[model samples]
Target chain A: MISVAVDAYGGDHAPQEVIKGIEFALRENSDLFVYLVGKEGELKGFIKGFEDSFRKRINIVDAPQVVRMSDKPSQALRLKNSSMAVGINLVKEGKADAFMTAGNSGAAMALAMFTLGRIKGVSRPAIATLLPTLEGQMLMLDVGANVDCKPQHLLEFSIMGYVYAKHVAGIDNPRVAVLSNGSEPGKGNQLTLSSYDLLSKSRLNFIGNIEGDEIYKGRADVVVCDGFVGNVVLKVSESIPDLIIEFLKEEIKRSFWYKIGFLLAKPAFRVLKSKTDYSSFGGAPLLGVRGSCIISHGRSNGVAIKNAILKAVKFSKEKVNDKIESAMEGCFVLKELKGAVRT
Target chain B: MISVAVDAYGGDHAPQEVIKGIEFALRENSDLFVYLVGKEGELKGFIKGFEDSFRKRINIVDAPQVVRMSDKPSQALRLKNSSMAVGINLVKEGKADAFMTAGNSGAAMALAMFTLGRIKGVSRPAIATLLPTLEGQMLMLDVGANVDCKPQHLLEFSIMGYVYAKHVAGIDNPRVAVLSNGSEPGKGNQLTLSSYDLLSKSRLNFIGNIEGDEIYKGRADVVVCDGFVGNVVLKVSESIPDLIIEFLKEEIKRSFWYKIGFLLAKPAFRVLKSKTDYSSFGGAPLLGVRGSCIISHGRSNGVAIKNAILKAVKFSKEKVNDKIESAMEGCFVLKELKGAVRT
Candidate 1:
């Protein structure tokens, strides 16, 4: 059994939905053990409904403090170890195989860095998330971690992300790309230009630079960039679908004819909404860390929290740490290959 | 009669749809003169079907130069006395009330600045596009003009965007917001924090910072930011709906029942599509310029072009320049207020 520590207070739904999501995840993998961390009272209130065997298998660690959505990343991190941080420490101490939290992502990264520690060759750990596009879901890393990233850092992110895609996402020889303003070899900011050279020289199948518009085109399986731009892209990817839906609703509401028409399209609307759902995919995996930790949205539901734990369970079994280490062991051979071609 | 210069070879459709759009605009306003700029051969081929009255109204300026979308912004501006440049020069020369193009936006901004200087107190101009949200269309500025902008530049963009929203979009006391990572007093990057202070101090009804998700919530009528974020938002806003539409299409194609159901809900789909229609709003307006210049989509049709021209006509008569100059005159007051607040 790959035991995982889950912060029950991390998400908006908190212990209630998070516990329920854990229940669902437990159903999928009967051998999975969850370490629920939060306020004893809140955690107990939700845990009361489960059976004795389930209760026996599940565990709780008291953590009264909470980090709010309004708190600064650094300020939140400084608090005397919230349930999320404590849960991460459990993984670092080898009490759990992996760590999961439907909590503040910034805090998650900080805790992972402080407790679990960064990989040997990795500069800063990156948080990658899956984007369900027209073709299929692709991996986009450094989504909101490490805003000011070096070119070498991006190369490592690409390697780690490439491995995740190949093993976890079942993508064979994933097409890795350095996200940029354009697809040209010489395109993008200074950071991306140098990263492009490193990526092109690597043994990993390196695609040329991918543009923002073509991100969803499914041209590249693994797309990498710094946190700032990546965060914008990630946020935009989520927001635009919502904007479209709202605009459609408003346009329909303006006229009676459109209102009646909207009712007919309800099923299709549900289907469209379903495609954008990332909750089932669990939280973002903090790669290049010694231990496994999946960071979910703070406002996540029971299922999303559960999915995060499920991802943690997978991370433990898949040997993500070993894979990331192996990927980083080599010098960017792709860089040498890339230098051969004209810029 | 508001005479405007229309670059005939400006967009993807160019002379053909642009001329048709011009005709559509002329249909609404009988007294309109257009100086069509393009290659003589291409211009003749496009205008062949129009009547002599239409022919008489439009003065064709034969220029053997064509501006490409891929051309660098610097190169487009440096094309010493090119057709696009010459057309813009007409606006600067006071021969036209406004200029319209659907071509390279970078080149357009470069030429607009070099040819027609910024308003006196305005430090920089921004591209303000109408976003079709549930609360009706909101004006979003700096879509693509300035790449890396300072807080001062964003503040100027906000004021100009506010004017465009209030005067052209007809929003009385438009609620303006600076897009940020969060909706708080002290949130987002350094640029937003500084811009927030400047905007809050202004007479324009400045709402505080808004998160990316709140965009669909209709939190404000004018969302201002630097061009990089603005362009990313705009492009994402354009792409996501199509992505959803594609998903729905494939889903419906799975079975005959789904296909039949889709047929029933065709009207609803149309309603949703109309909500996200960038064309309904036509091109974005280039604010802080001496003259009204509309930048339409490269993929715009004659109808969209016509609507764009009509919108430009409103700005031209609204005496946007007069209002902007008056706003700029108050810069000294604002600077003094900022100083007072600091002390």
Candidate 2:
């Protein structure tokens, strides 16, 4: 049975959705167990409300403090007994196979770095977000982990993204590319230019630089960039569909014929929304840490939380950390790249 | 009457679209004149095809060479008699009110900076692109002019974007925001972190940091970032609708009902397409240069080229360059930020 620890007092929905998600996960996967890490008194009554047989599988651990969404990562770190900290400790102590949280993302990353630490040869841990493409989904890394990253950090992100795409997503050979203004190998800022050289020499299937317009056209399975660019790309892409729909609504309201057309095309719009929904992917994995860590959105609901739990379970079963550690050992250039910080 | 010099031997459509665009512009606007800059032998026959009344207003200026899209800006600069160079010279020599090109953007920007120079205190010239929002269009600057930029460069972009938004876009008290990972002032990488500080103290209608997801929500009238981030955001946003349509077509094919739905909603999709189309905006203006220079896409068509010519006429009539030069003079902080190159 795979064991998972979840931060009960995390996310906008919090204990309500987190509790529903755990119940759903347990019902969906019979061989899975969970440790609810949060305020014991508050959560005990919630768990007791479920079926007696389901209640037997859940163990509530007391984490008196709660990390508010507004709190900074540094402030959250000071709360050693908080749900975010205690949940990470569960994975670090080997009491749980994986840790899942929808709590403060910066706090989660900070706690993971402080407690579980980096996997053997990994230089920087990155957040790998699964973005939908025309054909399927692509993996974009360093989403917000390290905003300012060195070329070597990007090389490591590419490697980690390659491994996760191969193992988790099951692509035979993932096509990897660095994001740039132009598609040419020489067309990029300083960070991408250096990362391009490192990626070219690596064992992975590294394609030349990819322009932003080619990202969703299914040009590459893995797109690597520093966290700053990656974050902007992810957020901008997320915002477009909503913006388009808003514009379409206004256009429809202008004409009686357009409103009728919108009604007829409701099914097609539903399919589009479902395909782009983040809840389908569950959550993004925080790669390069010693323990398995899955970080979901702050506003994530029950379904999103459930998917995140499943992703964590998959991460544990695949031994992704072991594979990453082994992959890092083979990266000969990382030795020289150590402590190379580029502002 | 505003006279606009257009590079005839530019873009994929070349003299065909360029000539067609000139005809369209002349037909639309009665008070406009154009100097068709390219090889006289190739363009004279094209101009002769127009009506005698229309032909009377068009003049052909012979530029012996054409700047290829692949040619380096430095290499293109050597050809002083090329269409790109001669067109810029028309504006610099006061022969034409504005210079417009659908040719090499890099070459156009380089020639503009070389010939026109900066607008007094301006450290680096920027390209301001009009991106569609739910309400209307917003201005995003430094699209690809400078790949790497300091905080001061971003500050200058904000000021220029504000002036353009107020004068050209006709927005009263335009809200300006710097692009960052989060909406908070302190939440960003080193570049944005420092930029946030400078922007907060600027005289412009500075709204705090804006996340990428909020860019198209009409959260701010002007969004500021380094050229690298701006280019990626622009290109990625441009590519998304195509990807969405491709996916929708595939989804539609999966069922007969979906196809029917797609057919009914064709009008709404058409409206959406027109709103997002780059051709509607014509071209991005290279701001902060001494003279008004408009750069269109290499793949721009007849309609796009025509719109670019119209945009150049508007830029010239607005005296945007003069306003920018005056704006730069009031910026007291720019003196210290003159040579601040981060990378």
State in Å the error of residue B147, model 2: 1.2
Per-residue C-alpha lDDT of model 2 across residues B1-343, encoded as one tens digit per residue? 8999999988988979989999999999999999999999988888877988788888899999999876778988999999999999998999999988988777888899999887876788899999988768799998988888888889889889988998889999899999988887667889888988887766778888899999998899999999899989989998888877887787788877667767777788888987888888899999989898898877788899989999999898899988887776664234444444211
lDDT of 1 by residue, A1-343 (tens): 7798988878677767788888887777889888888888878878888877678778888888887666667876777668877788788779899988877676788878888788766767899999886779899998776756677778788888988998889998889888765465644566788888777667878988887777787889999987766766776667777767666665566766556555655677677776787676677888888998888866688778778888888888989888877666664344454333212
**Lowest-lDDT window of 10 residues in candidate 1 chain A?**
A334-343
At residue B157, candidate 2 shows an lDDT of 90
In candidate 2, residue B59 scores what lDDT? 87
lDDT of 2 by residue, A204-274 (tens): 78997998998888889999998889889988988888888887888788877667767766777788987
Please give the interface root mean square deviation for model 1, in Å. Answer: 3.0
DockQ each: 0.40, 0.67
How close is every model to the real structure, measured as TM-score? 0.92, 0.94
State the C-alpha lDDT per candidate: 0.77, 0.86
Residue B187 alpha-carbon offset, candidate 1, angstroms: 4.2
